[model samples]
Target: MRSPTLARRERHDLCDLALVLGEDAPTLCGEWTAKELVAHLLVREHSPLGALGIAVETFARLTDRAMARLGRRDFAVLVEQLREPGLTPYALWPVEVLGNTLEYLVHHEDLRRAQTDWQPRENTPADDDAIWTAIRIGGRALVRPAGVPVRIRRADTGKEVTLRGGAEPVTIIGSPTEVTLFLFGRRQLHDVTFEGPTEKVAALRRAALGF
Candidate 1:
């Protein structure tokens, strides 16, 4: 299956999980309820103003205002809206596959891992491959902000990426999905092994790491 199809399936699974967990359930996204997360997703994919808000500081306030309004609506209603196909401008296609695959995957984990007893989801080989591809394409940029050299190694495939060049280097080892989650600033929640000087590792951990 293609990345977009996988992402779409993940979106549906997220809605289903949101229903099962209830709208008010906590998520890794600080202070955001499941309903709020759904609203963000909706705004991101369907609202041009909201999408612009993501990059342009001038539009951020507007996006936040939109999200606040959307959050007030019924939770199930919001989920249903997400389940429907997105607006034509934002429909899943060429870029959607690459852009949304990691997005939906990470957000899905955000909701699941926020729970006390949650375990890592069992992903298929295809899911693993897709996520690895995402990492190859975008992961370097995500970690570049850390200002320290870093290496990410996939325990399963031995695939690796040196994200930056610096005097001090840190290595993070995990499955592709776990590495993806870590790169997305979910380090505390993601189970991965870190090998490096204590100070360097601490710096890497403290540095903002994400899109």
Candidate 2:
């Protein structure tokens, strides 16, 4: 089984931070407090149909209702539930690795980058590789909808991957971890830069990126 070590680490760390900052602490998830964010995670894993609603627009109301119902539980209990991979299909090793590594990492940052005093967190080489792999796997799907070609570059190794194909692609430059966060929709909070045609760059920037 591929190691889901990064997913596990981020899960633990995110839960700890959620508790330390208390339920009302703000997060980068568009006005979701730490409490609401924790509830969302809980619903995503525990409720299969609810998780489906997350990506399928038609089922969004269902997801919203599930989150609202779970959000009423004690915040600490919600966090504890998320501290583990849980009993759902998400707990399967391969699924956990491919699906959750970036999910937890990005959500972790949603809590972190929202703080008044925040800085880019450091990552290990293994974690970097995992995040880069995850980007290669899921990043394209997130960016392709923008209709502009997109490429992402790792600032450290300079490794590049085409997220979308076109005449000219917007190249996003950052560490893999930051790039992962950027592509996942945390725009202003990440330390990444863009390069490409000015008009194309502006359009992509103005477009809501990430899933």
Candidate 3:
């Protein structure tokens, strides 16, 4: 039997936590509760029109409606469906690993980090490499709007990637997992540190940092 992909592990873990935390538990997806977050995931996988809206702002209303519809289901039902989804692209191993790994990673933390007693979970080197790969590929898009030179460094490996380029590049330093969170807009909750010009760092504080 094939071992589960990172995405599957994250997905299954998130589903487990969501069930334990219940539907109304807080999440980092703005004001969304666990139910809302799960609904969004379901819609992203199952609703053709809403899926487009997941990343595109123009179709947000459609996604909202779809989520609202899904949100009406029992919380356990929603999570179970996500864990054992039928015919969803995320169920396919390749797509699950490539497309959903980082997505679920961030969302898992979205739920995890919201609790008061939350603690940082250590990521293995393999998982760090997986997330680092995602940062190398997708980090550019999330950092581009900042408009300043941006570089991310993995603290342990000393490996680096440039996300956006310009003068006085800001170097974000941390484990890949923390860097991923910071890049994905969970700036305050991340363990990452930065090295850059005072002005550039200040500008980054004010700028929109992620997708």
Q: Name the best candidate (by TM-score).
A: 3
Which lDDT tens digits does candidate 1 get at residues 1-211?
A: 6444777788889999999999999999989989889988988877788878876887888789889999889999999999755565446476667778888888998899888889877788888888888887778888876777898888888877777766658988998888889888995455688988898888788888885
Q: After best superposition, candidate 3 residue 167: deviation in angstroms? A: 3.3
Error of 3 at 5 (Å): 0.9
Compared with the true structure, what per-residue lDDT tens digits does model 2 show for residues 132-185?
999998998888556799999999999999989888889989999888877776
What ranges in model 1 sit over 4 Å off?
A: 1-4, 188-190
Model 3 worst lDDT run, 10 consecutive residues:
202-211
Q: State residue 157's C-alpha deviation in candidate 3, in Å.
A: 1.2
Measured on C-alpha atoms, candidate 1 has an lDDT of 0.83
The true-structure Cα RMSD of candidate 1 reads 2.0
Cα error, residue 211 of model 3, in Å, equals 2.3
Q: How would you order the candidates by lDDT, starting with the best?
A: 3, 2, 1
Candidate 2 TM-score, true structure as reference: 0.94
